[model samples]
Target chain A: AQTVTQSQPEMSVQEAETVTLSCTYDTSENNYYLFWYKQPPSRQMILVIRQEAYKQQNATENRFSVNFQKAAKSFSLKISDSQLGDTAMYFCAFMRRLNSGGSNYKLTFGKGTLLTVNP
Target chain B: DAGVTQSPTHLIKTRGQQVTLRCSPISGHKSVSWYQQVLGQGPQFIFQYYEKEERGRGNFPDRFSARQFPNYSSELNVNALLLGDSALYLCASSMRTGGYTFGSGTRLTVV
Candidate 1:
């Protein structure tokens, strides 16, 4: 089994600034995927960004980027030019690589970090 | 195109009662998965269906069951619901390989 950990339970950042949320995982599998999801007050889980373990290059989507250290099992999310819309509960998730005939797409998530982007 | 849609945005049930939640995947999507999110916590995987077959299951008990239809839609049924079952239930759809698109989720409050 796999476990994802988000050490920071809560974090606050001023608008237009940058914030980084930490995440770590324990997995023996060599190939896998890491993800960051945001849930707002509406209770909808939205995908932020994703990283593939096989790739050394981290993933970037606009203002959202990831610093993935595969050897140390660390995957952190950095939000630049933060806005009030970024205030939400962020979760780190992990999924194993797909096999030939089995399903391994189920995501294992961390407790979550509530981010408050103050104006 | 429409994303994943889940029915009964919110509901209240009594203890030991039964509840069924519905989900409709996006067009052409053949995979649907369910998750439970408790207050102040992240979502937990419950079940996954592909091609109208059970593909994966989480550590939930047998009281939690689900099935998929030919159209790739799915239903999750929970029997003898307990207070702990009160939470947000999310449904997601995906292709064979890619990130999942999640629904707004059904809030089940077991009183």
Candidate 2:
């Protein structure tokens, strides 16, 4: 079993500024994947970014990037030049890599952090 | 292409009643997964299906059941609903190795 934790319940950032959301996880598996998802008022879960455990190089998607510290089990998301559209509930999730006989790709998620971008 | 589509955007049911939710995966996707998101919380995995077979199940009780069709569409049925079942149910579709694309979700409220 794996567990993901988001210590910050809420965060606020001014538009065009930068914000970082923290995430930590407990997993014994050596290979897996980490993800950040955002859910707006429309209630749709949208993928923000992803990181592969075997890759030392972090992942970056435009204004979104990740600081992944594999040894410490820490994966944090950095949103630069934040906009009002970034205001939403952000969740951190973990997924184990598919091995022999692994039939499904299940995501274990954290409680979430509510991010508000102030104008 | 159309994304994952779930039917009945919102539904309200009485306690102990039964409800069935539907999902239509993307045109080429062969896998479908279901999740439940409670208010103020992240979504929890409920079930996953691939090729019309059950691939994985979460910690939910047997009262929660689901099936996949030949077309890769899916249905989640919950019997003996409880007030705690009031939540948003999301459906996602993907290739075996790709990232998941989620639907807008169906809001189920058990009274």
Candidate 3:
């Protein structure tokens, strides 16, 4: 079974500053997918970034990016030039490969990091 | 143009009562998945349906069920609801390979 773990329970950042939330996972597969999701008080789960396990290069989107370390099983999200609207709970997730050993197209999610952006 | 949408933004039900949540996927999307998000936690997958067939299911009890309609919409049903069952029921749609677009979710509160 694949499991995701986010060590930070809460994180705070100042407007225009940066914040990095740490996440780690345990999986036996080599080729898989990792994701970061944002949930605001509005209760919407929005995708932030995704990383392919096989890709040695990390993924970046506008101001959001990931630092994926395959060997260490670490996938941390970095929000640069953070805006107030970016304040939300961030969840780290892991999806196992279909043919590897299981069939749960399901994403194993961590307990999430509650991020609050201060103005 | 449209994204995933869910109904009954908020609902309150007592323990042992049945609850149903609805979701409409993005147009032309063939896959719909359901997740349960409890307070202070990330969403947990409950079920996934494709082409009106059950393709995958999460670690949930038999009381939890879901189905996808011909139009690609879906519904999640929970029987004998318990207080622990109170959560935000989220619906997500995917095209292929499980990169999902999620809805705002239906907040279900079991008393």
lDDT per residue, candidate 3, B40-88, as tens digits?
Answer: 8888989888789887788999999998899999999999999999999
Question: Model 3 chain A, poorest ten-residue lDDT window?
Answer: A96-105
Give candidate 2's TM-score. Answer: 0.97
Could you give the candidate ranking by DockQ, starting with the highest?
1, 2, 3
Q: Model 1, B50-91: lDDT tens per residue?
A: 889888889899999999999999999999999999999999
Predicted candidate 3, C-alpha RMSD: 1.9
* Per-prediction share of native contacts kept: 0.61, 0.59, 0.61
TM-score of chain A of each: 0.95, 0.95, 0.93
- Looking at model 1, give its docking quality level: medium
Q: Per-prediction RMSD in angstroms?
A: 1.2, 1.2, 1.9
Please give, for residues A1-119, the per-residue lDDT of candidate 3 as tens digits: 88899999998999999999999999888788999999888888899999988788999999999999999999999999999999889999898643333333677899999999999
| Model 1 stretches with alpha carbons more than 4 Å out | A97-104
Question: What pairs collide in candidate 1?
Answer: none
Task: Select the stronger candidate by lDDT from 1 and 3.
Answer: 1
Candidates 1 onward: DockQ, in order:
0.65, 0.64, 0.58
DockQ winner among the candidates?
1
